[model samples]
Target: MLQRPTMPGYAAPQDLIRRVRRTWFLFFVVAIVIIAAALAGAEFYGRRSAIEALESQGRTDANLKVALLTAVLERPRALPLLLSEDQQVLDALSSANSQAIEILNRKLERLVTGTQAAVLYVVRPDGIAVSASNWREPLSFVGNDYNFRDYFRRAMEQGTAEQFALGSVSKRPGLFISRRVGSAVAPLGVVVVKMEFDRLETDWQSASRPVYVTDNHGVVLITSIPSWRFMTSGAIPQQDLASIRSSLQFGDAPLAPLPIKNPAILNPGASIVSAVLPGSGEAKYLRLLAAVPTTPWQLEYLVPIETPVASAVQTARLTALAFLLPVLAIAAFLLRRRQVSVMRIATEQAMREELERRVVERTEDLSRARDRLQAEISDHRDTEAKLQVVQQELVQANRLAILGQVAAGVAHEINQPVATIRAYADNARVFLERKQTDPVEENLGAIAALTERIGTITEELKAFARKGRVAPEPVDLRGVIEGAIVLLRSRFSGQLNALDAQLPPPGLFVMGNRIRLEQILINLLQNALEALGDRSDARVEITVTETSDEAAIAISDNGPGIPPAILDSLFTPFHTSKEQGLGLGLVISKDIVADYGGRIEVSSSDRGTCFTVYLLKAKT
Candidate 1:
């Protein structure tokens, strides 16, 4: 081997080899650490970005929901008024000749100009499209029948404004609003109003969602998303409709008429998504999907999220640059270390004179840690206090709700007898003043009978107000049923054709407070009695039947059957058919039944309305 010469201030060849090897080993270790750190940082950043992206998506969805709701709410509060105006138009059409109908339609066309409604149709109650804004066919809808629809029935039954069909008409999708024109007893007909759905569709202007409305059927009505008139025609493909039905459980059936909290504005599948829809010369792209059940229009908004491949490629390029820059800086520092070492040594000697630097850094770190711990403790205490307050509020609210239901039933029961007494007394007073001496005697007797009824009402109010603690003992089911009937007898005496009670043998007993059970019985019986209001020959049948573990009290009424829409929600709080009712009678009864480890159920048909309460049997 040839001898290698040594440079000045450098080590011998063997020593240089040893030093270089040691330095290379250290460099390799440092490089490995840097590579590991870089990988970990990249992974952490990626995970953090994903989480942030998800959070941002959630926020965007929430904001879109709010915006769609706001637009729907802003829709012409004048819808009901418009329906009323259409009633006048229809009324005029009923008597006017074709010339008059054409003239009136023209005037209406001018009135609703530039509005979301494109076409207005006045339909006859028989489902005939009577008049349109533009005259096309005279007998076009003359004999069309709409008698089988729930919307038509609703208008006739409730005599109120109602939403009807929301789909295609004359090759165009739209919404139909109708109002009963005549009396509640027998309405002349309904004033039907039709609006172009595209008008409603254009109302919603979201940039990132699919907006469309569905009828009671999962059929899509209107969407700002283009070429989606197929949904409005109620002709969605099977698979797509199935996907929508499964996710949202959509049905044409009307849900219980109870208050619905924030209903979702958009329904997925066979809906406007995954593809662009054609528009009628309006904006084509969609970002939000909004559907309004009140009308038959849905507004689809599409906002484009960045393409994943393009975004990924850009991100990777930036990431690579970030990684390469730190590595290049480390290599450059290493290459310049020799010259910098002497200056660093000098600088270190000068800076070593300061003793306070290390101490100050340690103190600052300890202060930061203490502040973080204190913030955490404060947050924990705030959460605990909020939870405690929520629990207390729930307890108080439950008590108040129960008390309110009880109070309403009591008031209703008292008012019935009081009303009868007032009628009798007023008749007696009129008889005395009319100088009819013969009938005066009968009226006086009626007044006395009415006074007795008033006394009964007072007693019932007192019993309902009783604050005594519940006392459970062996009690007769027949007695409870009869006592409740007695309290409510004045209410049903003449109103109902029969108040028959069929009880089992005297051995049927239940372990319950007599008064509370009586209250439950009265609630059920009163409901039956009230349902008999419109029946020609009203009757209520009460039967006591025994089960293996419990005794069942069944009350059946001959009034109109409970509405299918309301039957399920009847036991929920604040659900009632009566306009002035507190809607607590059935809810309180259910709670009482549950307390006894029993149940109350209802069955109804055209035959009558039947309610059965199952109570645990008392040991003899």
Candidate 2:
């Protein structure tokens, strides 16, 4: 079949044209879908970005307002304290007595009642009210005393006035300011200023919209919009007032305190963000809210929801048209001429080149992203490590606390024995001179016992040091108990006292660092002795009881039991009932027991106080 070269299944011109047309139809459909998707995405992202940017700007503005207000109110924070004793303002008020305060109050009422914020009161350093904006302020104030207030005293002592600042208006939403009267050298009283809702109304006139400044409390300081529902300040519901008040009085001191960072917003679900009044309910309104951390106030600017949307409508339409025109043109070009062989070839080559360029750009972007992720991980790990170190330091501090508590008794016990030893040796030297060998030997034996006691005391101290080393082993509970007794015996084994011990068998054991364990016993015993020291029938009893699973050593004294107030805080670091106490003993002892999976408890009543320590039984 040597026929002419067979062009197998090759498309004729008509068939080729039909296939090209079909491909073009499919591309046109795909292009339309892609363009629609891009426009929709752009609209969604743009709206969200716009909202976020607006909110951020609002917050910035609120912060600035709060800072300025705080700078004005700090003066008042001090005036309340200093006014009672200020010589000048007090002299002025005292000159008029009750009438003096009344007249001054009226003057202030005129100055502040119609202003943006209400003035609460102005008082002299001697604590007499000079003026007040609100009549109610006069009842509890005006000639009343302020001597007990620390704020007043500090202002006088410093002989300087506090600067203005922002705070809660009567703990509500308002602006407060105060200024000292007279000269700095011989100050008079202070001029207290407050601006509440009425004041806000004055300022609201300056703003275009129906605006109001409210605190976390729903208390409205100022508002331009007048609704019958919000006609009266007290008419506002309590919950709403509270919310607004809180928002207004937020801390303004930039250096006050940083919020906890782990979870940036301390309260979840609650809007840490500020928002516009939002039409009293869930009705959405365009609002700009700011969280002003300095004086920590929330500044809100509320507008009709329709306003922001309307303002943006014109721009939105222009952008949509701008984006849509190009997309339609590209789609149309793809549809037309697509059936031509030459056009198809060119389009295919263009698409391939575009894909290659995208691939190269994507590779570089991915590389940078990976590097950033690794660096973030490293930083996170370092932060975690630092937190762990801080936690350990806190733990070590607890250990030192207990040692510090018992140090006093330990010093007394050790020193008494040393003093007795010195006296006995000195007596022996005199006896030797008188040729009395027998008395000299007796004194020598007494000295040896005291020296041994001193050695035992030093051993207990070695365990109290805080360090990185842990040396725990099986130790006989009986021996530890007796060693503690021997160290305290010389000091407490006096004429009017009795000390007793009921130690368990030698086989009873606990696993602990020997020095630390002994130190704990000494601490408990010393506390018992001190408790019984002042009693004529002073008696201290020690009893050790054991079971298969655990062992307990109890110390009881026939003295007044632990005070109810101090019982709970006994083991807390740096807490003590004793006047001269360092307050570390129980805390250190508690930690030591916990380290070995043990516990210590104290019980007290009229019968007296008892401390019981339970240690896990070492395996036989």
Q: Please give, for residues 1-620, the per-residue lDDT of candidate 1 as tens digits.
A: 11222212222335544555566577667877776666566655654454345335544653565465546444533553465445457555467567666675676566556455544445555555455554444434333555654445576677554442433325443445556655676455655445554434554433324554445444544445544433443345668666544433223322222111222223341111234334322321213444544444453334333343234344544685577768766785675465345433443343333223434667675455446545754775698689889999998999998787666666754554465556656666787789777776775675576466556544644544552224367788878876676556645667645677886677678977665677688778778877777666878888888865689888898878888889878788778888887786777677667656678999887778999999988853
The list of candidate 2 runs beyond 4 A from truth reads 1-21, 52-194, 209-288, 291-296, 303-620
Reference-based TM-score, model 2: 0.32
Candidate 2: tens digits of C-alpha lDDT, residues 537-600: 8787888887767788888888888878888788886687777666767776887787777899
Clashes of each: 32, 67
Cα misplacement distance, residue 496 of candidate 2 (Å): 99
> How displaced is residue 21 in candidate 1, in Å?
5.6
